[model samples]
Target: MDLLHTLTHRHTTKAYDTERKIPAPVVAQLLEALRYSPSSVNSQPWHFFVADNDAGKAQIAKATSSPFAFNASRVMDASHVIVLSARNTLPPEYLQTLSDQEEADGRYANADARAQAHKGRAGFVGLHEQAGDVPVWTQKQTYIAQGFLLLSAALLGVDATPMEGFDAAILSTELELAEKGLSPAVIVALGYHSDADFNARLPKSRLPEKSIFSHI
Candidate 1:
């Protein structure tokens, strides 16, 4: 599975081969992918809750919906479910250093990088307010890891469903993640596909790349 083909063929799989279960080690690799996902200034903010138990899976299934924004049974049918608990803060020391770097950049040098650094700094500062002064820049960082997870799974012949439609409160409880103040954003269901259980979804939809991009 070349990266390109894996990316192109990776569909939002709601129909999982219920009889098949994803191996534990493979799941570990997926998490590893996230663990190593790139972050701004290496502020990796992601916690993956992998649920393989029946009751747990049911809870996730009950909470989440599909990409098209529909409730899905296939969520519970997959071999495993993953929850992303992304904080909205960069590390304090990391923030401190970044702030220092900006101040130390001679006050007027390297306009592009400095501009990017400034905007990036602003983002970190904005998210800090979200986490009650805790830096939460890692939420966006986690998605980079997620991209790797999706691509890795696809290339490995595993199917996946990334879902954001769920009751965040309930999912937090089911995963016992609230104590850490971790918030749930999305759930990825993983396994092979079962044609019998397919959700009758239309093929993937998207806007044209030309419309989505522009060059100055």
Candidate 2:
């Protein structure tokens, strides 16, 4: 597949064909891509809440009212909406759970290796904790996963509209994410584009390579 072509062709879908729905198999691939997204020291500190039905989508759409009302249709009319959330805090138990999963998956050679790996991951988490930016740090990781989801959608011929315009606090309350120690980070709507999507015909804008990159 021509990745560059896909990158250039994929636009943020502004309108979706509500009548159409993504196949279950394709949705599975997009979620799987998010599951394996990279993070610092493999700190997978995010959760995804998928809304495939009207009721579920309505719950997410609650956050899109008023000033964010413009995004309401994007959330409600899409075939699916994924609410990406980050862990509110990096508790020790959570870190140990990650280590245990790694061990169970045969990622560690032995107990010593497991301990060393755990310590290394904890050390990095400690830096963010000390800086009091643990929430910020985890949110950044969620964005990485979001990137994976977006690219995977494009590759699967799915149009995606990632939105940070919704009210996060309202979304958290509606989804009860805080009770689960999670904070809403971003939302992505997935579906096929509708005839009203002007972005599909517009040119992509970006700075020239020389201005945005430097090679030694």
Candidate 3:
């Protein structure tokens, strides 16, 4: 399908059919899409926690309690839920790990090239750290991955909803993310829309191009 067609048809699904599940192969492809998502300085400082089973979904549902009750059913009813997280810090070891992986993947021509790559990435990461908001910078990169996942899901004809209404702190604790140096950034629910999902019937609305875009 054309990319424009996919974008036009996709909407933030409000209700999902609990009985409908994404096939394992398709889910794997979506995961790949996220894995290959672009990030600043190629830091790739994000982790994805996918819940496709009842027990896992139940754990995520807790994040929607009380103040976040509005999105509880969206979590419980979707075929799968993905918790997007950002690393708390860009540790030196991680940059070394990326450098090693890049060399192994034949991204550099020689030792000098590899060193240069590491130095450049380290410099960029150091700048962010010095700014004293590394977590926020890392979280911004996670959103880029989220955007890729959303577009990939749309192209696959899967209904998805990007949700930020849940409690992040509760979710991080429930998912034991802090142990992994991760913090919840956002959640995405993926599945087929329910028959009662009125949001699908509503006309898609957007500002006119002239109002939102300009070319110098």
Candidate 4:
């Protein structure tokens, strides 16, 4: 695939074709991309809630009420909606769980290597905890996963809308994410765009690379 062409053509979808649905196989691939998304220290502190059915979508759409009403249709009409969430706190147990998983996955050649890996990741988590920025740090990682999902969707010929306009409190309550020690970071709607999507027809715009980049 032409990577530049894909990036240039991908746009945030506005209106979706309600009649269209993404094939299950394609959805699986998108989820895989999200699973492999990178995180600082390999913390992997995230959980995803996927909604494909009307009831589930409606539950998520509740958060888009009031000022965010504009995103309701995008949520309700899309083929799939994923609520990306981050851990409320990165407790030692959680960090240890990740360490154990890494060992199980053969990420370490020996016990000493495993211990060093855990120490490195825990040190970073400790720094964030001391700064009272654990939540912020984890949310940043969640957005990395969001980026992966959006790009993967684009590559699969699926339209995607990354939404941060929803009411977090409403979404957290509806999804009971807080009960699971998670908080909603973002929502992504995926489907095919409809004729009503004005954004699809607009040309892409951005500052020149020379203006945004600097060379040593």
Candidate 5:
């Protein structure tokens, strides 16, 4: 599919068909896309929790209850719910882990190359820590991955709704993210649009390019 067509056609799906499910292979590809998503300094400080079954989705839906109850049905009805999380800290050990993986993957040309790679990435990570908000910085990187997932899902003809309306604290507790040193950043529900999804038939809307973009 053409990139423009996919972007133009994709909209925030408000309702989903509960019975439609994504194929396992397609789910795998979407996950691979997330795994390979680019991050600043290759920090890659994010984890994804996927709920593809009713029981799992119900657990996630619990976070959307009460004041956020409107989102509960969407979470429950979607074929899958993906909770994207950011690491609470970008410690030296995590950077070392990334460096080790890179070395194992032959990303370094030599010993010096490996050393330089670690130095550069570690320096960038230090800047975030020195700024005193590693969580915010790390959460920002997760949005980049979310963008990739949005576009990839469009290409795969999957309807997705990116949501930040739920209770983050509730989600964190429900997912036990604190135990993993992670916090919820965003949630995306994926599935087919329901026949009653009025938004799907509406023309996509956006501000004029002249007002929203600048050539300079």
Candidate 6:
């Protein structure tokens, strides 16, 4: 199927059938597709670690409040656990380039002028703050990548789920992601869906396109 139809056809498959293990090559292909996703200044501040082993899956599974209570069981049930992560610290060059471009836009003139007017003020809001917080930028990019991974997995004919209901600190410790300054953004369970999972899913919800999109 084409990208458009693939997107429409893909659903978050919660109950992966115990039918088949998702092949390693399939997961690799999904990552290859994700490589093409857009990123801030092309910094590509995200990393993905595909987990199929018991110990590795447990590390991610433990990064939750219940630490195996809810979704952890599903980890073992799926063909693979896909950890979508983002770096806490972005590349200095990415931030620098972004700041320069934003400053060039001249949105800060009034703010800068005020600070200049008052020597003691030191009152100027830097372009970074105006650009939105760093964490926000990183988080946004991660979600975008998450979308890519999900779509890529779907296109590969693999079922997947994007899950955010988990603990980052626990996951960081469990996955040794702290040294890398990375934290789990989401965990996607990939495999073929069980017949039960499909039967239990709620109908999809969406707003009309006219309401969500803008022509003006």
Clashing pairs in 1: 88-135, 88-136, 88-137, 89-135, 89-136, 89-137, 90-135
Model 3 lDDT on a 0 to 1 scale = 0.93
lDDT of 2 at 173: 94
Which of candidates 2 and 6 is the stronger one according to TM-score?
2
Candidate 1 Cα lDDT to native: 0.71
For model 5, residues 54-114, the per-residue Cα lDDT tens digits are 8999988888978888888889999989999999998888888999999999899999999
Tell me how far candidate 1 lies from the true structure as C-alpha RMSD in angstroms.
Answer: 6.9
C-alpha local distance difference test of each model: 0.71, 0.95, 0.93, 0.95, 0.92, 0.70
lDDT (Cα, 0-100) at 206 in candidate 5: 92
| Model 4 per-residue lDDT tens digits across residues 1-216 | 688989999999999999999999999999999999999999998999999999999999999999999999999999999999999898999999999999999899999999999999899999998999999999999999999999999888999999999999999999999899999999999999999999999999999999999999
Give lDDT tens digits, candidate 1, residues 6-60: 6666788867787899888888887787777776654556678878878878777
RMSD of each: 6.9, 0.8, 0.8, 0.8, 0.8, 8.1
Q: What are the per-residue Cα lDDT tens digits for candidate 3 across 1-216?
A: 999889888999999998899999999999999999999988999999999998999999999988889899999999999999999998999999999999889999999999998999999999988999899999999999999999999999899999999888889889999999999999999999998899999988999999999899
Error of 2 at 163 (Å): 0.3
lDDT of 2 by residue, 32-124 (tens): 999999999999999999999999999999999889999999999999999999998989999999999999999988899999999999999
Off by over 4 Å in 4: none
Model 5, residue pairs in steric clash = none
Give the candidate order by descending lDDT.
Answer: 2, 4, 3, 5, 1, 6
> Which lDDT value does model 4 have at 166?
99
How far out, in Å, is residue 157 in model 3?
0.6
Per-prediction TM-score: 0.71, 0.98, 0.98, 0.98, 0.98, 0.74
Q: In candidate 6, what are the lDDT values of residues 1-216, reduced to their tens digit?
A: 798777677887767776688777887788786677887555466788888877777777776557446676567678888787887765445445545554566634775653343322112223434565655666778888888778778778888877876787777777788898886778887888887785336656679999989997
Screening candidate 6 with a backbone cut-off below 3 angstroms (N, C-alpha, C), the clashing residue pairs are: 17-194
Clashes of 5: 0
